[model samples]
Target: MPTGPALRIDLFLLAGLFPGLTHAAALGAAVDYAVAAERAGFDGVWLAEHHFSAYGTCPSAVVLAGHLLGRTDRLRVGTAAAILPNRHPIALAEETALLDAVSGGRFDLGVARGGPWVDLEVFGTGLDRYGHDGFAAALDLLLAGLSGAGTVAGDRHRFPFREVAMVPVAERGLPVWVAATGSSTVGLAAARGLPLLLGMHDDDAAKAAMLHGYARAGTGTPRAGHASTHLALVADTVEEAEAALRRTMPAWLAAAGGSERIDGSAPPRRDAGAYLEHLLAIHPVGPPARCVRRLAATVSTTGVRRLLLMVEGAGERRRTLANIERLGREVLAPLRRLH
Candidate 1:
């Protein structure tokens, strides 16, 4: 089993696009956040992709990954997931290999089936189930291309130039993870020997069960260890932490596709306060010591090698910055010690 602390940072940060914030500002903040995260001693930072919504602004995670990889030399940059079905497998493989070359092999590609439901509609993915048949087909094609397995094509994947070699091949195998949450998806990833990029909402039991099932179902050694991200904040007191959550979480969750559109046509932004219980129950949202304990327990329980904390969920720019700094300086040390 994996040992020692491997705390990382994940940002789907949209504080810049909250109701009162400017979209340009949010994008700028995202760039700065990546730079700052590197400076603050984060292991890696993953960018999220979404479209046609206020949830996240970046549609092209590869573009952002290239930009971020250029900005920071030490911090590994990855896509929390780049929805694979949105683009062709060969194109994705070619671009991924090129980015890996440029980044000195620091990129980790996370592939996922469409989600937020709206994204599926937007991407025109034919998969009836998010983690089932269509996604599996795309993944097979993508992996084959990445592995330089040219001169072949699957029935579901129609491509050209069978003799043309997939160029800009990675210096080493480019680490790829299947972003999964459901049991079937988890089993699928395991069966294929692909590592998992698990979602944030699952509590300990669900996460543990996934691991158990993976061990039972996986075909071969997984390429990389599993990773997960969730809400994490550190304050001086529990009340202060709760207050910060009350201020920022509703907007954050809504941005995460947690709510629905009431009018039957668009998203419904629900009350952040209404979800507080759920948040507090699952995340490390308290004072520094409490935060460390929760994180340590999670690490101990799930054996998740990479734990990405969503400190930017607080929404307010200044508060988000402060939380990032403090968590890096404060909570991380104790958790590492625990590990």
Candidate 2:
């Protein structure tokens, strides 16, 4: 349970609007969305990284965060996740340090051990290399480098120490978050006391199980926060919300992997109607009152202190931003009162 005020609200921007979209347009929209989120009083703005797909245009979240920081004032910018296995820890540490310095210590570093079989193939890297041990090594290395401790020597590589400190270390150490999907990764994150960034695609049951496992594993030190990301839209009525969701769910589902049953047997065959309902089930989408209730229930059930809302979908950027503003003003405010 969060021992403070209402759960902190962060806005997430999926790099591109949908598959087959223009990269330039997506980048512009992402920057615009970050600015809008800041104006809406969001605590932070998260950018997701994906490669070799229209699923996301900004393949490098570090660079995207740099751009966003220059554009927005007082908004914490970060990668929803930068796949750690694809890059060396030293370089990643340098980039993140620079981001923190340039952003005036407002950069949050969220890392993951990549995702999907295809993403690994695109990078020409095998998951076997980074499975669990490599992830742990990378996490330790990044943290050590960020803390300006010493050269990090892992099972894979050894860094020569020559008084090389990762530049621009913030007065306070960076908040490191790990993106966890599987049980092993979740347990590792908890054991390390790193914040957990729950993936966007998992269902409610899987989310609950993961959270339970994390809680059980996280007994020692409480060094990290827990956050979950979900797509959301607020409208005048459930019917209107469903209609908007219906327009975007098919493409997103197809991109994730068509119609194949997920772990919980949710997301009925990749068809239009089924996919829309599946998305709504996993997200908060509806009128303000209904969405607030759903969000509160999700928070209570998952025990996540932070909620990252994905305001961008396959719909028009204007509509997405408008919905986010509506959520902030109407939905989130009342939910805060309840809390």
Candidate 3:
């Protein structure tokens, strides 16, 4: 496993809000995951935000963050990225401040420009409609609001307000993160001296380029300097892990609209065996040792100390908890010594 300065390990929940799941049930499961994380010594739980999709059910990751923060004593709760354009900056700022106060500053607010056509439509903003200027405008309001400043007429989400400060000012200044994908976004975040909430799909070399870009821009570490990783366990055998990856990832990708299942019985998409071969070749999936090596290569490339593992969930409570337990012991426990 990769070793270095202490890594801040976090868990990112991408549990699908499939049919027959009540909102209450979903919230309950999130709580359970947080409780498990804290007990197992994970650093934080990062909730993902999605609109009108079974891929991610958490409509309000901040709301769930507060709930999780209230439930766990030490575990930090954050949004993977709150769709900034979909909400008024004032609302996002106020809620973030309140959560920070109650959690004693354990909340990390990650703001992003919303995308994917359906998500835009859910908020009546088309994919083509929400351009960088609009996102920057919203981001400006958010940053200003976080600094407890008020807005004027130019704000797109809300306009023409007084020296408005974020009510219930944050206990202290909260650590705010911007989600970065492309070079422009990374540069935008670096220019502001803000750390990044990075995504997980890029290869090590690609990620290294992004990291170096951030470094060339300036050093701003996200929550003790961690990047996110897509994770799973294969203690018994690599083959078994491959099967799970093949089985779970396609449905997840299809649900999130990243890929499709053109035919259930076809090769590649539905064939877990075929898909598993391709997946393990790229991502952090293997027996504990290989997983650690792949993940370490990732950390070394990115030079970020924190890792939020996006563990795959097949909608089973026991399976989710079990995956957490396995990774904590098999993957992270050994690495914890470096800290």
Clashes of 3: 3
TM per candidate comes to 0.88, 0.87, 0.84
> For residues 280-315, could you state the per-residue lDDT of candidate 2 as single tens digits?
776788788887887787777776767888887646
Looking at model 3, the pairs that clash are: 225-305, 225-306, 226-306
lDDT of 1 by residue, 219-262 (tens): 86586788877788788888888887777667656665542322
The top-ranked prediction according to TM-score is: 1
Predictions in order: lDDT = 0.73, 0.75, 0.70
The candidates, ranked best first by lDDT, are 2, 1, 3
Instruction: Provide the clashing-pair count of each candidate structure.
Output: 5, 0, 3
Model 2 weakest 10-residue run by lDDT: 256-265
Predicted model with the maximum lDDT: 2
* Per-residue lDDT over 84-145 for candidate 3, one digit per residue giving the tens place of the 0 to 100 score: 87777778888998888777778988877756445565666455335776677677767777
After TM-score superposition, what is the CA distance of residue 82 in candidate 2 from its true location, in Å?
A: 0.4
TM-score attained by model 1: 0.88
